[model samples]
Target: MPAARQHLFLLCLLLPISLSYEIQLILVNNCNYSVWPGVLGSAGHATPEDGGFHLGLGEEAVFDVPSWWSGRVWGRQGCGFDGQGKGSCDSGDCGGMLQCKGAGGAPPATVVEMTFGTDRSPLHFYDVSLVDGFNLPVTMAPVGGGVGCGVAGCEVDLNVCCPSKLEVKRNGKVVGCKSACLALKADKYCCTGDYGSPKICKPTLFSHLFKSICPRAYSFAFDDSSSLNICRASRYLITFCPPAR
Candidate 1:
């Protein structure tokens, strides 16, 4: 329950808030002691003499991300000698090894990213939370749910449907719309077919739903927030996207 760990529980602020590769590595001594990535070179990799870098409380270090590499990066505390922060050590994991436990050596960060990456989206996220439209929290097993109702079980548990068009907007500016999953849970469209025309929730139904549902609590920018979280329970849900069949 370190101070830094508590506040900065999660994030993905990207890197280039200032300039990509220009400043990739940074050190913060908000802990009892401090640590640095030392000089890892352009490979975005740090070596021994280069690793085990240390700092004092209230201290800060900054290093440029290696120019050669591209992907996710981090400044983690190694369970090194003495033990994590104070140079103490860990009996297991990185036992002082770099990249071990992913700097689990210390708690989360308090002085977090001040900016984001430009070349790409600056994000150090819980890669665990997202995977297509399927989130482990809402539905456990891979069995998709929404498609059927009052039924026993089915392969696609989660169902999805889109309107003829979706009226979209951003920041209250009315960006436009596209008929799609206006609701997050898993929309159950109208099966009321007309002369076997395959009746389902039509554009008007979904359009009305979106008008009544999304805009009030959500916006375009909130794509980061879980759509399932907004609405509690519903027989019909809408979505801009859905998992692959």
Candidate 2:
């Protein structure tokens, strides 16, 4: 074979391995009951696992997300879906569909957001957010620890202590906790108008309570720097109904 042809063949042989780096997300359901895992990819990103799937108690689903993928994941409880995938959930329902596709979960749901690395940037960013509210406990941690990689999530079940006015009830039970912003929708609570920046939108009493309970999770808008985590890892584990700390 010609030298150039030999070189080209070798490159082709190694290309798949070189581009095989992926972010493996293991979604584990640790609750006593079954839960449906909902996934929503960011703009231009592809939702994996058909966007949603059912996970019985103690079951887990693994997804191989391409590098640079950006998306959010959450859990839905008490969902009743027909064969055609049409249904409603007690919490975190996405347009009455079993597969969320690109649809985001309803408010009062705990969310895990992740952005993987790109060629220009190698750092992966991830965080658990309670800014919308909390329906279930969640935790996100790298499979293998990397330098400066920190776990982010709310290990405690916020529903137990959810304020009466901010509680979302289903069958006379608190199914989810509502953020003051979602409960009130005021500019001050939502961090809008003049209170849009980190400098101005300081944590409120409610936000402070959430932060105290889940210090690593994002409690409100502009809760960056402290809540946002940067790491580089090949795999991450997201547990629903995470064990209490």
Candidate 3:
């Protein structure tokens, strides 16, 4: 082949590799006690930090995931793990394993869900969901400013005022606040069956309370639009027990 043709072929081979980008997720623990952060990736997506790991007060963990990554993260409390990564947590336990692997954390645990962008359309979506319930305060925000990007999370601790019927107690202390749907298991609360649609599944009193407390967070399954945040950033920060503004 001619020299020019060989050079063109080499450039084409490197094009795809140069266009790829990885997103960085920084998980911070600001709680007074220790926490075990759990990560669960979506189908066909790799979980960088899939196994649960320990984070003491003021500690943090950073993970680099593919640009097309999609997953959920949560914090586990009161965990007791053996040397073999076998253990249990008071809240958000993942089958008594230190590393959650592919297993999801048990409720009532505050969950941070995120879906990164693809090369074709580079838009990242993220939200803090209370649909399962809330064990700790969590905030998800882009590391740097991005146009039209808003933060999503619950800054205040919900366990302080959790309704008696919805509180999860451990050692006589409220550790988590269950969503009404989880507490009631009714179609109206769970937004299932006939109530699956947004129009039919209006916010309940409990959801209203949650929204009033944390306007940026998703209080229920149908809570979207306002709760969901879209952005295009290389890095994001998910903080447990986020500091008060």
Which segments of model 1 are wrong by more than 4 Å?
1-21, 34-51, 67-93, 98-245
Can you write out model 2's per-residue Cα lDDT over 3-122, one digit (the tens) per residue? 999999999999867866778999999999999999999999999987899999999999899888999999999899999999899999999999998899998999999999964576
Top TM-score prediction, candidate number: 3
Q: How many times do residue backbones clash in model 3?
A: 1
Residue 11 of model 3: what lDDT?
A: 97
Q: Write the per-residue lDDT of candidate 3 for residues 107-179, one digit (tens) a residue.
A: 9999999999977788999999999999999999998878668889999999999999999999999989998
Q: TM-scores across all candidates?
A: 0.25, 0.93, 0.95
Best-to-worst ranking by TM-score = 3, 2, 1
Candidate 1: deviation at residue 55, Å? 1.9
The Cα local distance difference test for each model comes to 0.27, 0.91, 0.91
Per-residue lDDT over 74-186 for candidate 1, one digit per residue giving the tens place of the 0 to 100 score: 23332344443343321112234543323322211111111212335432211111111110011111123232211111112111222324322224432222323333323
Q: Which stretches of model 2 miss by more than 4 angstroms?
A: 1-17
lDDT of 2: 0.91
Indicate the worst ten consecutive residues by lDDT in candidate 1: 131-140
As for TM-score, the candidate ahead, 2 or 3, is: 3
